[model samples]
Target: MNDIPEPNNESDSSAPIHEARLWRDDGWTARVIKNEDDDGWAVEMIKDGEAEPALVGPWTMGRDKKNPKPLDTGAFNTLVKTASEVLRRHEQQLHALLHKSIAVTTDSGTINVVLDIVPDEDDPYAMLSATDEFGDAIAEVRVAPTFKLTRASAEAWIESGYRKPR
Candidate 1:
């Protein structure tokens, strides 16, 4: 007879599917699953309400190569921390890639300069824009994604009447 409990149909969708080697916490879930590439164990850490796992790594093997070391408070806590860091770094990197902002002082007034990149498979482009202190858009232009945005470049663009870069 199997000792593990069956999944409760009444449980919330966000709730982790608990088994012998699965654990659910407020913000994350840790589950031990078979490593499809090899005859070993791997652990997947899924964040709350997320469809995909934030981290998937090898699990320590027990005396039997086929069995994984049981998940404990210490191990689970470490996994949670690692997985959270991974998600944090990924978010930071994506933010940097999609958007960037800088403050510049122009003859008119200090303005917030922003560069928003739109990545397309065939053609990538970026939008360069500037806003006044009151959040009014002063100027905007579309440029290549590789265009370098700096104080000098922004000043030049504004001086050129928002002309498309050469």
Candidate 2:
């Protein structure tokens, strides 16, 4: 039924179970399915409470060479580890893309300028801010998400007396 929500990581949740084609364990589910591009098998690893799979790759063929190897504890554990790494890397990449900072020297001294983007469906924007060496907030302004922060831009902004950029 489409009504039942998938299992979440909780103490009372169902225990890990492994079937020939599906294995659910350690807050991850590994499913072996037919490869759409070829006449081979592929395994997909999906994290708990997530719709999209985090990793998918070719599966080892069974001895018969016509079927996929049954999912086992060792195989399932390896898949979970790989999928977790993939998710972690993706998160790091996203963080670097959305947050940027630069240092520029002014008459008063040097300050660190940072741009933090807040993505919203209806009102997407970014916070352009500056901080002193002691981590004190010097200035901040709302800017378009497309604002590109660089040393030159930061210097110009500070030189303008912290005025909002055009």
TM-score of each: 0.70, 0.89
Which window of 10 residues has the lowest lDDT sum in candidate 1?
Answer: 1-10
Residue-level lDDT of model 2, residues 34-70, one tens digit each, is 8889978899999878989999999999999988888
- What would the per-residue lDDT of candidate 1 be over residues 1-166, giving only the tens digit for each residue? 4332333558875675445478776677888887879978888988877889999999999877668888877888899999999999998999898898888787788888899999989999999898998999888888899988877887777778778777
Clashes of each: 0, 0
**Which numbered prediction scores highest in TM-score against the true structure?**
2
| Regions of model 2 farther than 4 Å from truth | 1-14
Q: Clashing residue pairs in candidate 1, if any? A: none
Q: How high is the CA lDDT of each candidate model?
A: 0.82, 0.87
